[model samples]
Target: MTRKEEVFERVEKSILDFDGDKAVEVAKEAINSGVEPVEVIERGVRKALETVGKKYETGELFIIHLAAAGEAANRAINEVLKPEIEKKGEEIHFTGKVLIGTVAGDIHEIGKTIVSAMLLASGFEVTDLGKDVPIETFVREVKEQNPDILGMSALLSTTIPVQKDVIEALQKEGLRDKVKVMVGGAPVTQEWAEEIGADAYGVDAVDAMKKARKLVGA
Candidate 1:
């Protein structure tokens, strides 16, 4: 394999092994060897997470494995590549800008964390508003950030209505047409997404990446 290809392989392996330090080492090596940070994310980290997502879907990998892989990928990006890009004053060619959060009353964050990592690897600039985010916070962020997409997660059945409430808030503020809305979580369904006027319903992190790409025409 070519040198960059070899580095990409090692990066992918480091993530699959859930070795954040190794992933960071490989990321530094990639930067030193003249690989663009975005290229590492797209060809290396993203490819690895795609496999992990498939394994999870087939029941070969569980939630813990997913979380581990996500953590490793995030460390490689946040710890290594990000700083390098900022140092070089390089403009990251992001696929799109996404604002994501877990709805109010739901402290569940595992799913949102995974999706954020996957989205970052997929080349989207993601701003994670974190768990238990209030409806007004969602609306205000959309207004301020003007992101290409707004994603909401609600793991609990009772908290699911908060997703709809946020969408309604966006409409009330007349910002509904400014950005696409995506909703997901354990209790979220396609029917629910449609009923709430969501632009897309993500079944999983992989699906979320795909739908986000389509939503932004990336």
Candidate 2:
């Protein structure tokens, strides 16, 4: 294989193995060697996550593995994509800026972390509000961040309605029309997202990228 392909394979393997620093090194080297962040993420990060997900479903890997891989890939992508992302220049088209957070009462962040990395790969500037975000925090972030998309994530069925609460808060603040809302979670569905008035539903990190971009018109 070519050097770029080798880097892709190495980075992919590092994420599957949950080797955070190794992934960071491979991703950074891919950049230093002139490989685009988008290419590396599509060919490596997402590819690796797909494998990890399959393994998880089959019990070859567990939730611990999934969480570890997600965190590792997030760090690696952030490190490697920073330079190229900064150099995006002023005139480029973007999928959109996204404000991402896990809703209140949901401390699990694996899904949100993976979603953030994939969005970054797809060229969306993401403001991650971390886990267990309150409705007020989401509204305040929208007012301050002015992002084109508000991405709410929850891992628990009980916490899913917090996304609806955030939507209500945004609606009450008259900011609902200003930005699109996207929802995702273990128990979330398109019907639920629609019921909550979300612009899109993300079934996974890859689906999130496409759905968010489509909603934001990018």
Candidate 3:
């Protein structure tokens, strides 16, 4: 295999092995080997996570596996590849800026984390707010960051209401029309998303990336 292809293989394998350190190490090696940072992210990290997503969907992998793989890929991208891209004065050509979080009272982050990694791999500049994010924090972030898309994940039916609350809060702050809102989780449905006035609904990470791209005309 060519040197670039070999580096891509190691990067993908590092994520599959769920080794963040190895991912970073491979990322630096890729740069030193003259592999473009964006190519490493798209061809290496993205491909690895796509496989991880499929395995998780097929029940061959558990949530822990998905989380570990996603986190490892994200760490390498954020900590290594991104800095390299910056150093080379290369604009990432991101699809858009996305702010994502798991709504309050829901500590479940596996779904959100996977979606965040997928979005990042798909060329979206993602800002993850982590789990149990308050409605006010979402609103505050929307106003402050002014991202193109805001994605919320809630794993529990009880916390699903928090998604609506956040939307309403955004409306109250006069920020609802400024950004497209996407919602997803185990219990979130198309009907629920519409009822809550979300701009889009994602059934999974891949679907989320598609919908997000469409949301921004990317």
Give the TM-scores of the predictions, in the order they appear: 0.74, 0.62, 0.75
lDDT string for model 2 (1-218, tens) is: 99899989998999888899999988888888988787787788878877876776588976667767867777876676655765764132345788999999999987988788667545566778999998899999999979999998888888998998999999999999999999998999999998999999989887988888788777
Question: Pick by TM-score: which candidate is best?
Answer: 3
Q: On residues 53-169, what C-alpha lDDT tens digit does candidate 1 reach at each position?
A: 788779898777877887888799889987888888975567899999999999998899888877865667788999999999999999998999999999899999999899899
lDDT string for model 3 (1-218, tens) is: 98788899999999999999999999999988888999998889888877987887688987678768878887898999989888889866567999999999999998898888777655678899999999999999999989999999999989999999999999999999999999999999999999989999999887998999999998
Candidate 1 residues lying further than 4 Å off, grouped into runs, are 1-6, 32-34, 50-63, 93-96, 111-125, 155-158, 172-174, 186-191, 203-210
Cα deviation of 59, candidate 2, in Å: 3.7
Selected candidate, larger lDDT, 2 vs 3: 3
- Residue 93, candidate 3: Cα error in Å is 4.1
Total backbone collisions, model 2 = 0
TM-score of candidate 1 versus the correct structure, residues matched by position: 0.74
- Compared with the true structure, all predictions reach lDDT values of 0.89, 0.83, 0.90
- Superposing every Cα of model 2 onto the true structure, what RMSD results? 5.2
